[model samples]
Target: MAVTRQSVEQFDLDLSELHNDSTTVRFYGDYEEFEEPVQRRGKQTAAMRQGHSKDHRPDLKQLLYILTVSEDGGVPVYFTTDDGDKHDDQTHIPTWDLLKELTGRTDFLYIADCKLASSENLAHLHRQKGRFITILPKNRSEPRKMRQLLTDDPDCVSWKTLYEIRDEDGNLEHRFRTPREEEMTKDGYRLIWIHSLVKETTDEASRMKAIGKTTSELSRFRARLRSPRTLMRQRHRVQEEVEAILAKRPVGSFLSVEVIQEEEVTLKQATPGRRSKKTQYTKETKLRFDLSWKIDADALEVAKRSDGIFPLITNDSKLSAEDVLRAYKRQPIIEKRFSQLKTDSCVAPVYLKEVSRIESLLCVYFLALVIQTLIEREIRRAMDSSGIESVPLYPEGRACRRPTTRRLIDALSSLSHHRLQTDDGDTLSLYTQPTSLQSQLIKLMGLRPSSYGRKKN
Candidate 1:
């Protein structure tokens, strides 16, 4: 941690804002019998237990891997491996405290997901004079209240325009708006509701697709209701099936269903294979259920009114809503570090049963992540300083704006050295010539040219 802090200072990273998030690393061994973490012999080991696996591998034992990265270049500053069952909300306090200790301050804006929005977490940070920006979970009444308020009387809420940006096609790509604060959250924090034109269009398209699919199924079901082969007779059963279909998607709110019940009478011959006078006819009465549905135009309109809206909560009153939103947007950079941990570093499939070895392996993974990010950051920074936009790292000289560490390694993979034994009992060394691209990249990374050459004794 000290070394990482030193490196952050050396690189002049933006310590003003840091992002924290966690991912689960799964193990594939028979860990059904393992000792819990104990302080035996002055040593501590991480516990392997089953928790929420972000990788969606609950069948395998896992350790919750938490990371804190700088927004400057997504460089990982600190990481911890916790018991698999550790909840995300439970991690923020310790992480914030550690970052405070490392950065020597508590004023850095901590950005995380909704897990950081709990009353305890927010209150703790606020009390410590720490600032944070996080999304308001939909389950919270605050968001619903704002949505309801807006729906009831559209004019009741006032909005301030943030900015407008155009896309490559010269069309409006995004327009951001935030509700002017006429009121504050019950917790005395700023609740800024943002409206996005892009999100609104995307949401509307998704709703239309879902509605079309549900309506088609309902239409087919209604047609089957009139068919003689239809066996769905109970009204409650029919309603249950229709509700299930609607529940499959979020289009149920715009739909209203009615189950229509009717009685059908049929005559059947009691005696089979018999003639006219000897046969007895029996009358049967059966109930049939049909359905009628229509789109609730009023409900649809109400929903449309709030389309493309999301709420952000922050305690830092000095920053505007747009700045808070932009800071929260950087939260995904930490996810990139997690991706590198899993993919580039391959920090999974623990073949060791001992918790000590697992803990050591996690430490090595963290070190590897730091090294990888450093190399990536250095190269990108060099490119920016040299006024270069893209590099030919792809096949057939394709351009890459942001070169990845894996690609850089692949570019240098073919460089090799060979030793030849002479008849005079002397050895000669030969090295493959570096490609122009390799030389360019090597120079950009500011490595000594001899770093890739054969060493002289």
Candidate 2:
């Protein structure tokens, strides 16, 4: 908290808009002590328990790292650790309250994921006269209603092109649109739905891939059922297997499975010798099961109709759909900070078992993120002020428009100073000469090249 306050005052950061998000840090080993919160320094440490692992390692225990950053330069302003089992929706109210206390205002637009759209969280923020923008979860009725509306009448919704993004070659990369008619959530909050051409194509392709995978797996399972050693002869077992296959993919709604049963009969001579009329025969019967599936054309068409659409809910009605989208788009800034925390800083694979020490280490990670973002912000600001578009920060003298802190560190990593003592007791000092690109990077960061290896007094 002190570091965040100092950063805001030192850098004159913008407090009008803040983005908040959380990520899980996975830890290995059996942390018996952390099965529950442990008290230290008169405060309980966050428990490292199993929960929804964003790292996709549910087998390993983890703790959630919640961070909020300023939109000015993606500088982290607030962070906290929570129990791994804690749900994202349950953390927003307390986080919002802390932001209010930290910023000394309630008007800052807090942006987050669908977890922030919960009724309890939104109502609390709204009641406190706070403004926020968040994605509406697909489970919500508003999205279902809009999808059904679109499915019924494809042209019912009037769309206005909000913006378009183009590549350097002037080719269209993405296009965004919103309905002309204003929509409101059931709770009376402004609900704006956005359509993206790129996202639509991506969603359609992903759905088809999943459906193809599901179909292939079902075909394999059908082939397995024919094997003589296969134990899946019962109809219920076959149905269960089908359910398990469908559960692994989101294409379950678009496919239907049926278990077909048939009876098999055999006749054998009782005396173990085949004789036509004199020998008695024994008959035995057994049941066999098979699986068949088909893709539901109607359901697939309905889902396709809603492919590119997503809803954004906001309590601030004065903000237009474009403004909401522009603000929400910056939500990835917090995600980028999280990426740096995990990947650049390597905050995961925590070797420490003590929750208090882990918390302290997370604090250090937060401080590191702050320093990194400050350096990045300063260099970018310098580049803009000097009218420079890009620098050779990439390998083989490739130009990099927006340089990251990791790249800066890599560029300066090879620099070193060596000292030698002669037999006559004379000391010599040698410093690695900075390359042109390195010198330019130093200048862009507002540092003097001559002071690169100097000792501080």
Candidate 3:
């Protein structure tokens, strides 16, 4: 572990900012066969247990995988396994300390998701003079206050556009923002609210679709109310049915429901047969129920005011809102590492039952991630330095401007070497020459072409 840390440090990659996240690696075997927290060589390690499976496989046992990566091209720097039952919030403190030790510094920025927003984690990092940025939890009072302010009078809160990125067609790709006024309190840290143009558009479209669906459903219910075979005989039943429909759909907030009652009178003859003197007309009153709904324009307006808004909390007052936004944006880099760890590497569904060996196997997987990241980083850097925009790494000679390590490995998968043995115990070796693309990739990666197959004497 020390040697690996030294190697990463030696590369001089950006250690100024680090991102952290966790996921679960599942196993199907009977992990219970081995005693958990078993002592091995005077050291105890936790065995597989059930937790909230990130892979959505709750039936299987798993180990919680905590990983941290540098913001420079998502190169993994630190990783550790935990008992599956542990929560992510509880792991952040230890992870921060481990990263501090690894980097031998305290001024670097630590970024993560909302799990790092807890008072304990934030307070601990602040006490140690370490800086961090993370998403604000919705349950916090500051966000509630902001939403209320925005809903009551949107102009009351001033906002400034932080930055914007555009696509090739001159379309807005994304934009970030923060409130122009100081949103911090004496007890609270710096709070920046971000608005995504894409999210706002999507939210509006989805809201309209849900409202339309609810309207159509209510029309059908109203038709049923007038039907003679309707089962909703009681007024409460009709109201309950309406509530159920609103609950299932996304239109509850913008919709209003009411049950209207009306009386119907019918006349009948006093006797079964018509009689001139003895017959008297009788009037019977029947109660009828109906439903009425309208879009709560006020509530809908309030929801619209807060669409596409997300908040971030940070203690570093020196960093501008854009800097914090950019740092927190790198949080997804760690997520990509988790993705490559699971999908590209196929690290799940372990075949081993022994818990000790499983832990060791995880270490090997971590090493593989490190090696793959190095190769990818090297190739990309070489491409940038040499003014190479794209490479033909895809199927049918398609171009890949930013190639992944998996695709690069697959491109070289067909190269092979053959060895023949004679009856007299003499041997001859033959190697297949690499294709132009393979040779180019090898050169970009600073590897010899002969490294793909047997070397010539």
TM-score of each: 0.87, 0.93, 0.82
Off by over 4 Å in 2: 168-170, 266-281, 422-425, 453-457
Error of 2 at 42 (Å): 1.4
Residues 1-457, model 3: lDDT tens digits: 5845765777668888888999998887766754367887787776678879888888878888889888887888888888877789999999999899988999889999989988888989999999988988888887888788888888876778999999999888988776787567335688778887777878888898899998899999999988877666688888888988998777887888888877768888867886687788899877777889999888887789888888888889998888888888778877877888889989976888777788889888988998888788889999999999999988899999988899998998888888899999999878878988998999999889888766679
> For model 1, which pairs clash?
none
121-167: candidate 2 lDDT, tens digit per residue: 99999999999999999888988888899989888899999999999
TM-score between model 3 and native: 0.82
Model 1 CA deviation exceeding 4 Å by range: 28-30, 34-51, 57-61, 168-170, 212-235, 262-277, 285-292, 421-424, 453-457
Best prediction by TM-score:
2
**Candidate 2: minimum summed lDDT over ten consecutive residues — where?**
448-457
lDDT of 3 at 267: 82
In order, what is each prediction's RMSD in angstroms? Answer: 3.4, 2.6, 5.1
Top candidate by lDDT: 2
State each model's CA lDDT, in order: 0.86, 0.90, 0.84
Taking the tens digit of each residue's C-alpha lDDT, what string does model 1 give over 207-266? 888899999999898888889989888887888889898999988779888888899999
